[model samples]
Target: MKSNPSTDPPAEFLARMSALLPAAEFAAFLAAFDRPARVGLRVNTLKISVPDFISIAPFSLAPLGDWEPAGFLVTDDSRPGRHPYHDAGLYYLQEPSAMVAAALLAAAPGERVLDLAAAPGGKATHLLSRMAGPLPDAPLSALRRGLSSGGLLVANDVHGGRARLLADNLARWGAVNALVTQAEPAHLAASFGPVFDRVLIDAPCSGEGMLRRGEPVEWSAAIVAACARRQRGILAHAPQLARPGGRLLYSTCTFAPEENEAVIAAFLAGAPDFTVIEPARHAAFERGRPDWSAAPPAIADQLARAVRLWPHRFPGEGHFMALLGRDGEPGDEATRVAPFRRVPPSGEQWRLWRDFAEASLTVALPEERIHAHNDRLYLLPAAAVAVERLRIVRYGLLLGEMRPGRFQPAPDLALALRAGDATAALDLWPDDPQLAAYMSGAELLQAGADGWVLVAVAGFGLGWAKRAAGRLKNHYPRGWRRG
Candidate 1:
């Protein structure tokens, strides 16, 4: 493979890659390298069903040929990045090939699932859309129902900074049921042994499939072999993290057989109880090449079940996937693990906030949902276990409604609450002249004394506020205030 003169190729990268595969295979990899850099995303089911999303989207929605429900061959567009819908979380921007990995996991609502290496929230949000069900037809009715029960999607990232992005994305999408966690794979597996109904290991790989985006990678047998070793450790321990009878979907964006079929074959050999299910029956996903028998004769048959997504063949990035199912039940008679404690605020403190909240905002904070954590009060859902045992990455996880009695909608709720008759909201932004003045840490003027005003920037709602005395107190958090 010639190193293109335009790119500053890494040392021996081309030479190394050529030694690992035939010239024809190297050419195919190069041809897939021509497309643009960004990945695509489809709207989730919970926010909008596939059929409905297609009806509204200004693109021709077709079967990604290899992917299932809602997956599509999105026409390349520069607008999604700038569109309001994208900002409103109407759709997710994801790698077209990456979509296949999540769909293959086949998780559903009311089921417990874990995204072992979730960060920047691509797969986790896709899974969240599945749990939130669909919006109702009766305008305000569906809006209210959507918030009533945001299902659980425990999105975790090992790094602390990335977990914040994961939480931010989930919140931006209004999938409030999602809880963020920062933990190692081993710790998570130990805490919730065999409890996850579905687990997605979009495992870290050699980035062979990402050459186009990251610049051409110099592939070599030794590098591929090393990646295979790392893949094996994660794959071997992945089953222990899944509930007995649960599903584990392993995927990577690279084309190394060492990291793809060989890793699965090695694990299955040692763990006899798990079986490789046919991908065709589940989602009619495209299958990997069946010609590797001559090279890896021992695992030739098992390789037939693995799925591959090549950039040349599919509309997205290149990827490899295999679905494995565990045998036996998930075990019996297990007690719930109490990981979080909800200590209520003191009576005097609660009364002060409660009275202030009742008089100032349109969204009512219920006593049951309101709990003190790390010295801060948050209104969360009853089933939000992801909060327990995990550091509070983002609070106000569950969005509430503006019940009468001095309540107002949150900025996110404003878009959601817009479906119903909401009182006029104040247009403000982080740097709004009014906001800047208010942030001088002083209250600004309100037109009326004790009335509701939507706190906004431009036209987007941030939260709510009230007018008292001659000052407009910023209801936005002191912690959340612009530093």
Candidate 2:
């Protein structure tokens, strides 16, 4: 006799899920676990339009419908992640369900935004692009101009390593108005103090929704409970960083009610200033089950406004989201930019950078935005405030570093620059051997001026090159070199 498929999951988890979902729906959900996982990507609107990407894209893509305008379901074996377009920050490979939270946040241009647990930068990048409006049609000279003139995005992660990765992705995506930080929630709450127009907590969860990814997780009641407790703690500090009348978006990839509805219910009880708002719903999205929470009917009914994405009903993995609006008038607190202390370069130091910028850059970088910390130089956003206490990995756009005498451009500066921003550049096609050589950290035979040159692929900046004698010396970061 064949074994029962229902028993594939731990009996306790199955029982809990059965109690939460309708009998037929629970069975369908279980069957969905056996099906192949869906592959999806969100077009980086900062670089290419949805229609333009579709026209030039090598793979076949089916629209993910109105739920997400930029999201698409991959229908072919083409590895877009490995493509040169990815290096150019043309798109981001993300789970279809995970894309819902940022869209629900509905971040408008010029709003102060924060991705509390942002790492690997899927949602953070999405938020950045949304704030910047449509960059595909914008001129190259206007590329640095993002959504709001004073709007800023602070992407934070607790882990240092992930924080670095977050900075890398945002840099590639050309988020000029972003700041990357690694800090605890309590610390952020203390420093920011209810200042953000929108705060997103894609909270840490028990990975219940990612089972189809082929990773084995030892699911137990204790693990689920622990995750719920941690999520509540994170949510507790979220409101402190959100301005009154601003919005806070809470999301998780777990199916456990403890981590989803229960946490939200508890938060609603404690934070009277914040109220749950109904997210834009679709037929594919199910309302949060009030009965599943331990709260009273009145409170539980409020939780119903939250949205849930089930793998069985939708072509994506499980996800839960609740958008909460803080009550009050829009105050100056929401618009106050951080007061970042400037570290101006000395006369000698300024000369080196000025010479390089004059020679290589077509656009002039404002002196106020440029700062020098020791040997490294950075270009902060115009609205950047002081973050003296936070563990910031990257304060702003890293312009480059000062060596013994000459100024060396950072890879981040190259990636952040538009095609028209660089006066001297070596443009190569994706298939060009020289492109491979530059990416692999090999010397390029291309001759140019005896100074810095932007190495570009398909009009998108890849990295930097220093030309001297007769050839271009590859300046791509060794850590990012393609093997």
Candidate with the greatest lDDT versus the true structure:
2
Candidate 2 lDDT score at position 13: 75
lDDT scores of the candidates, listed in order: 0.62, 0.84
Angstrom error of the Cα, residue 187, model 2: value is 0.6
RMSD of each: 5.8, 2.4
Query: What 10-residue stretch in candidate 1 is worst by lDDT?
Result: 413-422
Q: What count of clashes does model 1 give?
A: 13
Pairs of colliding residues, candidate 2: 132-147, 338-385, 338-386, 339-385, 339-386, 340-385, 340-386
Model 2's alpha-carbon lDDT is: 0.84
lDDT per residue (tens digit) for residues 244-289 in model 1 = 7888888888876677877887887787777777765333356765
lDDT of 2 at 81: 83
